[model samples]
Target: MESKDLVSDDGRITYRSGVAARLAGLSPETLRVWERRYNLSNVERSARGQRLYSAEQVRRLSLLKQLVDQGHAIGVLAPMSVDRLQELAGAAAGRPKAAGPLKVGVVGANLARRIAASNRDGSDLVVQHSWSHLDQVALTSPLADVEVLVIELSELHDSALPLILSAARACDGAAVVVLYRFCASATIRALRAHACLAARVPADVGELLSLCRSALAGDRLPPAPPLPTSDLRFDEDALFNIMASGSGLACECPKHLADLLLMVGSFERYSAQCASRNEDDAQLHNELGRAAGQARVILEAAMERLARADGLPLPPGLIK
Candidate 1:
């Protein structure tokens, strides 16, 4: 594991963990921490089960480490696309970029400050203007170049609708989000009638940012991925019973399939946890987790089909 070894598997060149860390200007331990915390990708493993990083992954780590060295947080960068990370690194080096993060204007003072601080080490969305209240924002204000406007309210009612519409007009139709702690369903429906969006106060600043991104993307965002099941189809006792019943069979395939399903299902749960830990990486981790979940389901179905063919009785809960 400590050797500076190079490997090529499946025709994709790879580097040993140590070699990758060194090339990326990172210590081996830091790389391990990032891997364990972020679950960056489905990392490849050597024949001995030692970790190996693909060439592209090493290059990405080098970019990430460079940015981290310049004071960026690994948590924020871990969930970003390579192009986004490259853009951040180039900007840090005083190099120009094609474009920047989505510009967002917060109409609430407290929310603005919180978003700006949260995004200080992140990419994708930026806090542009922070007006203390909706009344303070107008047509003559810094409305230009503000792609989205986020307004926060403690309570929302019918009367406030006019002023909110006025603020939206002032921004020249920039997509608006009204985050309120209290609101009626009818009021939310009315707001949406005018091409406006409304939601209750987000549980956290990260949720707020995700809302902004999704609002702007609108129909472009893909449907939400399915979460892995907290309760697996087969319990330990059931799986053990199945294995015991398969003892007289020609092979131990049933036990092996069950073991593989358990491992894959666990990874599915872990990937979902990683997605929740950081919004930046949520999309990537969600996709990975969903894929694993789908695979687990397929494996379970195959085991059931084969078991039935071999005259094995599945647990009651597992039957269709």
Candidate 2:
């Protein structure tokens, strides 16, 4: 076919028989044979009599080839529309599904409430819990076997990756989607390395869903890390319940513990990030992290003692 014959008279794009066959994973001889024998493909001919196929024709031909390869007879499938062929192929493959609502724990700008309200029907995605700030997340446990965690923020830096990672670690290694207003490509790559995906927002529900699907389908979730000994002593729900229960108290004990928890938690996170980010000062940051972890252990002891004395109810894991 001549170069000029690749397009048709209607100003629509088209491909010659050879290109079309290659694109549809068929040989020109097979395409011609099918056209001659079964009228499987409709092709326009240039004035020079070279066959031309439109993109739609190519697409249909591709689907026909797919269904045929899947053991369907070409005679029966060639009559099916693109949508029906798609449905058939999907059913044959069991359709890609995340299955059930993708429960998400969130930290950023009341995102949990927003996502929860959007998914009141519970068919797709659900909010496990929403924390307005990462500080709230750092001080308490919020992950509840969620499959995804959405972190919304204005900007993301390398320093922030450890915090985000820590939250993911705490979430049983839920896939992470970081929606930000500004993020560098390098940081996005770094996020990807840690099995976190990043996108700039104002992403709507559809875009967010797409990113979430990619995060899930990519098998990007890291294995859930082992919980620290301190974590084994108290689960998130217990900490959250205790903190809420103590809000009514005038003792100021929980307040003090909350502050300590936040400080040490932040420092432990900071030190760990520092160690990872700085090779020159690795010893210093690792030492800082260990010291901070010890401080957190002491605080946890105080919290457990306080919770028991205040008659706070613990989650089933801690009840015994």
Candidate 3:
């Protein structure tokens, strides 16, 4: 069903599967599985046979996801009513219905202001610290006592990875939410691998708040898949030869090729450090592997192009 179907003249609001998934912090596939296996919610079918969910159902699903993240078994929570589920969650947390506000540390002033404004009507969230840059969070660990850390960035750059990692460490077990104006797929994947939640900018404040709640409740998604490395074996002599040939190429090819090579080399060094530190499971390591894999592809293509330009014989393995 299209998103337009979310509103009706009867004053009831419904959401399609995609919208529901976003609200509930679940994938559409996971929602379908829940519907088929656990009968978690009463989903309706659109005229085109697409799934539709009511507002209450979405809330239940969000609560379920949060509970599951808190280590509650889905089989137990799925069969219970929303009130019962809330009671159980509150009991598990050893808190009253109206618990104290969550302490939050925000990295950007604008984000801090927006969060403050959003909570003007009252919410169980408090902004304890605000910094104009991530560097401050990394250095001062101002968020060390907060329950959650929210960082706002214009873009996700390689240089920012260390700062993010350091902030995560300082915050102890606090959940992290990274809101970016623009981010690459690799960067998103990397952040997820490190247990950091990422969201795009221009998002609804409600959704962001929901994300924060879920994160604080321990509802983190699985790590991204490891980078493909089956064909990434690096041959020292072949790479040296390619660089030598690329250096003599006309135009920008030489510079681009050199940059790619340097990037790959840097990634390799970073990966080695991660392994030495026993941080092979860390997000930065996986990101470095993915970056190195990408660089290898470009470097190989450049080598092939240089070989064609020089009329040199191509290596059998590099034919593709």
TM-score, every prediction: 0.37, 0.40, 0.40
Clashing pairs in 1: none
lDDT of each: 0.71, 0.68, 0.68
Can you tell me which runs of candidate 3 are displaced by over 4 Å?
1-100, 221-320
Candidate 2 at residue 229, lDDT? 35
- Indicate the TM-score of model 2: 0.40
Q: List residue ranges in candidate 1 displaced over 4 A.
A: 1-100, 120-122, 219-320
Candidate 1 vs 3: which has more lDDT: 1
Error of 2 at 230 (Å): 42
lDDT tens string, model 1, 151-235? Answer: 9874566667888888877777777888875565677767766656677766557777666654554311032456757546665
- Give residue 59's lDDT in candidate 2 (0 to 100): 88
Candidate 2, residue 64: lDDT: 77
Clashes of each: 0, 0, 0
Over the stretch 42-102, how does candidate 2's per-residue lDDT look in tens digits? 6788787978888998988887777666435566576778889877667656635576567
Candidate 2 Cα RMSD after full superposition onto the native fold (Å): 17.7
lDDT of 2 at 190: 79
